[model samples]
Target: MNIQMNNIHKSFGTNRVLSGVDFDLREGEVHALMGENGAGKSTLMNILIGLHARDEGIIMIDGKETYFANPKEAERSGIAFIHQELNIWPEMTVLDNLFIGKEMTNKFGWLSTKEMKALAQEQLDRLSVSLPLLSEAGACSVGQQQMIEIAKALMTRARVIVMDEPTAALTEREIQKLFEVIRALKKEGVSIVYISHRMEEIFAICDRITIMRDGRTVDTKDIPETNFDEVVRKMVGRELTERYPSRHPSPGRKVLEVKGLTRQGWFENVNFDVHEGEIVGFSGLMGSGRTEMMRSLFGLDPLDGGEVIMKGHPVRIRKPVDAVKHGIGFITEDRKDEGLILDFSIRENMALTNLFSFSNKGFISGAKEKDFVDTLIKRLQIKTQSAETAAGNLSGGNQQKVVIAKWVGIGPSLLILDEPTRGVDVGAKREIYQLMNELTERGVAIIMVSSELPEVLGMSDRIVVVHEGRIAGELTREEATQENIMTLATGGQ
Candidate 1:
């Protein structure tokens, strides 16, 4: 089970994303593919999986030249891809999802329930998962769904597994379980191509690291031979002095407060406060109701019961538009589906939140719009050929930047960011942190909903932990520690 991709070239219109890219995956080795967004890592993997065609390349499997016309062909050749975005049907049972296209059939072509269930159970057992086969896949937690994805791959008897950001949305406990499964598979002589934005994972789990930057392979080194700083420098082509920007939070008057926030089945009695010059972090495990609370506060989701006070005035926000009028903005976690209009140009997306500022009577001033968009694009360091370029054409990190720039341009007194750095790379993550620091310095309060413990500890002036739709505890920066946060997050004292 070996893969050799040589001289790969890919282009989307005039944008050349990959040029002369090369990658190698050997049997029984955990090979990490490291790169910044748009560094050609995703493009190359897509070509191998038959999602995209390379303009020029030769793919050799076990020293034999091969071509995959479609995903089925690649799958049949013992390759399986677990995308960063989990693809599963919520209405379907876990059993059905695992045997979707590769179902076993009897003599008359009838689905073999007995065989499918047995095989699915075996795969789950291999991963040490306890999910019921007949349970609805959608009703499970993010961690459970991830394990199901892995089970599906194992059921295919894949010799090479490509996992892209497998732990992006998983909790620390779930991540440890996932690592245990990965190790089990490795013991069975399976080769893995692991792609991730978190540099620590590369050092912790991979055998070798290959860095890609600006559509080219920068370098490859054994895990033991290279250091984190060197790997980051290769990926971004520059020295990174500090991972997080320095923050001096000078708390001002309370700008926003939540009293008795409740959403029937989602959360209840959620309460918190954000000061004018502070960043308040909401920390919890997945499904702790952090997201639901923010969505309700921003009026994206209805609040069954609560009071939102802005600048010491009680305000009734029943919808997102109302929240916007009251100087509030939200950046959702699912950026692709919720954050940006993919078909719209970058300029239009950037202007979305602040479009009213450019409107005179009813007509928008193109001059004002262009000036603001240009300034945001430059200030945020978004990489795009032109403002007219489609938002969907940009890389994940750049699209996230566009979303932030749009919301930042709106001049909201309080901004809510959910999973702001989920799939963003190291350099982009640092930039976002700096942006948050700047926003808070300007008297703009921020409410950050995050699953990363380190992020919450590093950037937050105060931390709020939620458990089972309740405020488990609150801690000041000095009082917060990973051990204490975890204890409270799991419903401890």
Candidate 2:
């Protein structure tokens, strides 16, 4: 399962994605692919798996030149790709999703239900996962769905696996389990192409690292030979001074307050208040009801019992429009599904939340829209050729910037950011943090919900821990620590 990609080149129309990129994976070793968004990391992997044809390259597999016709062909050849956006069929049963196209048949040409269940159970057991085979795949949490994808890959007996941002949706416990599985796979002679923006994970698990910048390979080094600062410099082609910007909070009047907020079956009895020029971080493990509570606050979900107070006045927010009308903006966790319209131009997506400001007599003003978009693009340091570019075409980091820009256009007195920097690179992450500081400086209150502990501690003026549909504890900036937060999140005193 050794793979060597030399001088790989690919282009989409006039946009060159990969240029003279070189990557190699040794048998039984975890090789990391590190880069900023739009650096061609994913593009190069897509070429390796036959999703995109390389315009120029030599792909050597086990000392022989090989090119897969398609992903299925690649899988049959012992290469499996578990993408960031999973391919689980929601309505289908877990067993059905596992054996979708490659189902076993009995001697009579009937579906081999018993055999499939046994095999699926075996794979899940190997990964230390517990899931009901007959349950609908959609009912599972994101972390469970992630494990299902891993189990599906393992069922193929793949000698090579490409995992893209695999731990993005996983919790601390699930991530450790995944790491254990990866270690077992490595011992079993499986090679892994680990692609992620998390530097800590890369250094923790990978044996070697390949850094890419602007569609070309910058350098490749052994994990022991390189450090975090060195890898970041090579990825962004600059010295990134700070990972998180410094913030000095000066609290103002209360902007948002929740009293006895209850979302049936999700979260209950939630009580908190966010003041102007303050950053309140919600820290919790996956499915700890943090996101569910945020959704209810933004009026995306029904609150069976609650009181939302804005500026000392209790207001009813039954829908997103109601929240927005009251000067509240929300940036959802899933950027592609909830934050932006992939097919729309940047201008269109940015204007979606502030149509009234950019319209006159019910007709949109292109001039006003362009000016606003340009200003935010410049202010946010969004890397794009034009504001007219489709948001789907932009890299993950730039797309996040666009999402933030759209909310900023509304001039919200309070903003709720859920997983604001989830898949963003180190450089883009700093920019987002700086933007948060700027927003707070302008008297804008912010409620940030995040799974990254370092980010939660670095950016928040105060932290609230959520555990199993309830507020576990609250810690001020001076009192918060990783150990205490984890303790609270796990329901410990």
Candidate 3:
């Protein structure tokens, strides 16, 4: 099946998100979409998946004009979309989730558990995924859950699949397995629309590439005919310099020290220290409790035992407010769930943690809020027309910038960032790296948790690798090679 969108125009009131957007995907080929934050990729995907209606356009499926009123209609037309965020039930088993809406039924109209379980096992085996059918969905790793979502879509016989940031949460080995599955799907004549900010993945898997800028098609070219620099030029309309700025050594005395930090089942005996003007990285597998430890530090998660010493003084953090008062801020890994209030305006969201500073005696001051957000917006280089814009309407990269800005506004002594550049484009990623450098120059102690090895090596002054809820090893800049880090991360001696 081939999908073609012609002259698609969509708008929310006076703000036109997409203007004459044109793109196509062909069978047996992966079409990669490239864009920066606020480039209208999400809006276009939403239109294709029937989440939003196009003000004017033509959608042709298999060379026939069509319109999808809802996701069910799109699925019925053999189109499926796997979002960046995995949509799976945590409490449900893999077999139950796979056959949820379309369950195998018995004569009494009850679910046929055995039949569904067998089918689910076959699907998993076909993809060479080794997860048990009876295991709860959330109990599995992020990569495993991603595979389950893909299997569910394949079971529906979807001819065209739209995958957004598919490899954001995957390890190198797991990514290879996913690429293998994608090749198998291509062999089966399934057309795939792959959207990602990672240039390496795009060049590796895509047959053709389409670049979008400001909601309009920029150019379409074969993957082999172009290099990363060329594709980036088209996607961002500018040449990017070095991705990571040079690390400046301004390490002072220890600003944060943790001795035997334990959260029982989450993490055990975690010990590390971050000095003033230093960026320390936490690298581990998906479930290695990097996020849990950070949450505990921010007072969002309870610590069973251990201690957090700030500037050689132990501080008790019972809640998020206490952490904030202690001069600590956290930019969560899951932005949509923990970071931002989507329905709120940009100014309102930025003022969430530090709203009291802008209020006079419990009375809010709109002018002060605007002044604070306006300065941060300019400083962060956030791409938005106005401060009144809804945070949800921004692109993933811009939304991430907003989250960072919110914390920067609070002027914390210590900042914890998890996967800061997860869904951000290369251009924005460079900006973020610069921002991290700026923060370090200001003598702020920073702790970063990321799955990207290159990022861990590039940004961190020191790296700590965790495996199975324990500190596997630690390395300085010169000792942090990929092989060395992987050996520790994979539980090697």
TM-score of every candidate relative to the true structure? 0.94, 0.97, 0.95
- Model 2 regions lying over 4 Å from their true place: none
Specify the highest-lDDT model's number: 2
- Report the lDDT tens digits of candidate 3 across residue range 1-493: 9889989999888778899999998888999998987788878988998989999999997889888899888998888888877788989998888988888999999888888888888877777777778889878866678888878887888888889888887778778777898898899999889999988899999999989998898989999999988888888898886767899878988888888889888899989899989999999887778888889888898998888998889999989998888789899877876789989989889998879879998999988988899998998889888888999878888889999999988888899999999899888899899988998899989999998988999999999999988999999999999899999999996
Q: Candidate 1: which pairs clash?
A: none
Instruction: Show pairs that collide, candidate 2.
Output: none
lDDT of 2 by residue, 1-493 (tens): 8999999999988888888999999999999998988888888988888998999989999999999999999999999999877789989999999999999998899999999999999888877778989999988877788888988988899999999889887888888888999998999999999999999999999999999999999999999999999999999889988888888899999999999999889999999999999999999988899999989998999999989999999999999999999999999888877899999999889999988998999999888988999999999888778898999888877888999999999999999999899778888888889889999999999999988999899999999999999999999999999999999999999
402-436 in candidate 1: lDDT tens per residue?
Answer: 99998999899999999899878998899999999
What ranking emerges by lDDT with the best candidate at the front? 2, 1, 3
Quality of model 3 by C-alpha lDDT: 0.87
Residue 69 of model 1: what lDDT? 90
Query: Least accurate stretch of 10 residues (summed lDDT) in model 1?
Result: 123-132
Return the candidate ranking by TM-score, descending: 2, 3, 1
